[model samples]
Target: MKDKLARNISIYRKEQGLTQEELAKLLGISFQAVSKWENAQTMPDITLLPALSTILEVSVDKLLGYVAQDKRITIYEDEYQTEDYYWGTEPNTACYQVLQLIPPTKPLKLLDIGCGEGKDAVFFARNGYEVDAFDVTNAGIEKTRRLADRTGVHVNVFKADLLEFRLDTHYDIIFSSGVLHYMKPEYRADIFDNYKRFTNENGMHVFNVFVNKPFIAPPPEKETNAYPWQSGQLLTYYHDWLIRDSAEIVFDCNSSGIPHQHAMTTMVAQKITTSP
Candidate 1:
């Protein structure tokens, strides 16, 4: 809990564009005290928490690493309840890239972050990669389990909010798809750091995010929580890692029963301990 609180404070502070000194000034405390709280070396005084929460624009519960039970942030929660798979059960083409780049000839652990309906997770499990996947919606979690069971493969599926969840265990391959754009821009750096830190040496990250472009317009789905990334933004985080492949593409979509176009960036980067 302490670790999560520390991380949330750091992330939210940066999100509000406040330096430690600035936050300290606002809270009538010393910067060192703020630093200590962010470092997880000490906890903020109970009296200070409410003020901290107000300044950071987050609730006290979130600051203390708790998500409200009644809150449902995902837009797909209702769509996922339908009998037919909303996004279809076919694995994304990125799964093939994973197979090509790092064939699972040996035992490998994989995690599907923001897994919607479990198509890619089931694909990896069928191909002999130990798979675990999560989504924010309970409906999505149930569908992933149903699909995995029908496919006769095991997938450790669960529900999680991407913002509140952090990887504590190691994985050889980590994959996320269109779901990453839900994260606010300020929170991405720390989230990526956690991901890169928990990945095994020589592990790969297969990810893609919808990118904002002048030529292409937004899709029909007006999702309040979605935040499209800037072009090339995803690659910026992998500067020290080995970039096996990267590309930006424009695609047609009919997600909300309307014809539209979107620009997206895709990357397959590998973690190499030594300079590559």
Candidate 2:
């Protein structure tokens, strides 16, 4: 456990481009103390874990190296077999809004993370963008491929888990509609960092997440499928980017014909720098 924590701390600190002295200054500790922690010679005081995690842009669980036993791949496989458009067939409204905000240029290269049925990916491909879409389940990928064929549009659809997927190419537009929030909280920072890293300069990212709300009841205790963001939490991850559009709204959940109110945070931001 100590080794894992030390390794994670070192990796995250370097990812943020902070030296021991710099991280120590942020933590109000001495450089030697930071070095010791990274060296596995000592641990940070328990009380400092929260502040340390906040500065490193990770959750405390991640700092301590908690691994999520994710069941999304299996759950999604079952869901896709029963409902083709479990989330909906129409592209999200935010996707259209983001298209309008894109600068006038040649057709862009786009990637859709967690693209279930390829509706949005096909929509973009039909409009002339080179699109690549991925989902974790084979059923989802199969559905997306069929949708692309039915629409007479070409889309590269594959099954890949977001946590382990690597990008061979950068994209001018990265769209993830309602998918990211399903990640475990401890893993979100790394996922967001990857999004920024694989986005081309001046490219845009459009996504949405469920946010914690007093009015919305929590999912069942045994359900680990969704992780809701704290209010205003999503924007904090994009501090180095230029926010083009954002909204917090409460809406009806019509995707599965399930009638329920959901509080969500939607954002469209442009990459201004290579790092965030």
Compare the candidates by TM-score and give the number of the best one.
Answer: 1
Displacement of residue 160 (Cα, Å) in model 1 is: 2.6
lDDT of 1 by residue, 74-129 (tens): 77999999999999999999999999988899999999999989999999999999
lDDT value, candidate 1, whole model: 0.90
Name the lDDT value of residue 152 in candidate 1: 100
Q: Write the per-residue lDDT of candidate 2 for residues 78-196, one digit (tens) a residue.
A: 77886547665777787678668883369788999889777788888887788999887777888888878888999998776665454657999988886776676666786688778
Q: CA lDDT of 201 in candidate 2?
A: 92
TM match of model 2 to true structure: 0.70
Q: Locate the minimum summed-lDDT window of 10 residues in model 1.
A: 65-74
